[model samples]
Target: MTPKRVLVAYGTKHGATAGIAEQIGTSLREDGLDAVVLPADDVDDVRDYDAVVLGGALYAGHWSRKAKRCAERNADSLKHRPVYLFSSGPLDSSAEQQDVPPVPAVAQQMERLGAREHATFGGSVTAQTPGLMARVLVRSGKAGDFRNPERIQSWAHHISAELATLP
Candidate 1:
């Protein structure tokens, strides 16, 4: 029996969302699935994978353009597969504390694709993050890396378990 192929694609600014996608891919692989992680811009098609986990970084309460465009471009194919959506943002612990519903755009995408679940993960912003706003936030002590590895792994494992039950 062949292992199921899963694609973990992300749209990120300053690489935080990519890191989350990589974590999801690793967890999926550990569960004995064939998972590949890629940048959203590079994913031209979803026809090759049995399932997909698509994620984006949030900016001003909006999903990244790259991520949104990827979903729009592959809407037809994605709708036919098991799909999960995620957003990486909230420089604070809000995401870990409670369910942060998807932004309006992401919600629309989730409905359009019939996604099984959506997770909102904490984001990162530090002095090293290039941007005047990031620097300002860092100076104000309002930015930090809030991504919880345990939560990410747990969600990925949940997806893995769900996929196991699928054809």
Candidate 2:
């Protein structure tokens, strides 16, 4: 049998989310799946892959515009495949501690698209990397690096395992 092909598409602002997507792809590949990581804007179609993992950075309680558009544009194709959604933004120490909510529009879209799973991961912030306003937020202790690599890898492995069982 041909290896299952998975697309890990993401939207990022400061690149933290992109890094997470790449890690997810790597973990999937290690689990004997074929995975490709790309920015949401770059992925023109989802029909070529057997499964898809869409993720984005959250800002002001919203998913990145590119990710939202990707979901909307490819809703039909995505609904027919094994689809997963993830949001990477919450400067909390743990995923459980995050008070952030999913973007309402995106949530509705995911439901309509028959997404298999959805997850929220911790995010990171750095005073040196962000702009002036973001720097202030980081300095004020409102933001900090809270991403957990182990958790990300574990999630990817789970997805790989699930895909392997698909007919």
Deviation of model 1 at 81, angstroms = 0.2
lDDT of 2 by residue, 141-164 (tens): 787777889989999999988988
Candidate 1, residues 27-126: lDDT per residue as tens digits? 9999999999999999999999999999999999999999999999999999999999999999999999899999999999999999998999999998
Alpha-carbon lDDT, every model = 0.96, 0.87
Please give each candidate's TM-score: 0.99, 0.93
Model 2 residue 131 lDDT?
Answer: 78
Q: Which number leads on TM-score? A: 1
Range of the 10 consecutive residues with the lowest summed lDDT in candidate 2 = 93-102
Give each model's clash number. Answer: 0, 0
Residue 73: error of model 2 in Å? 1.4
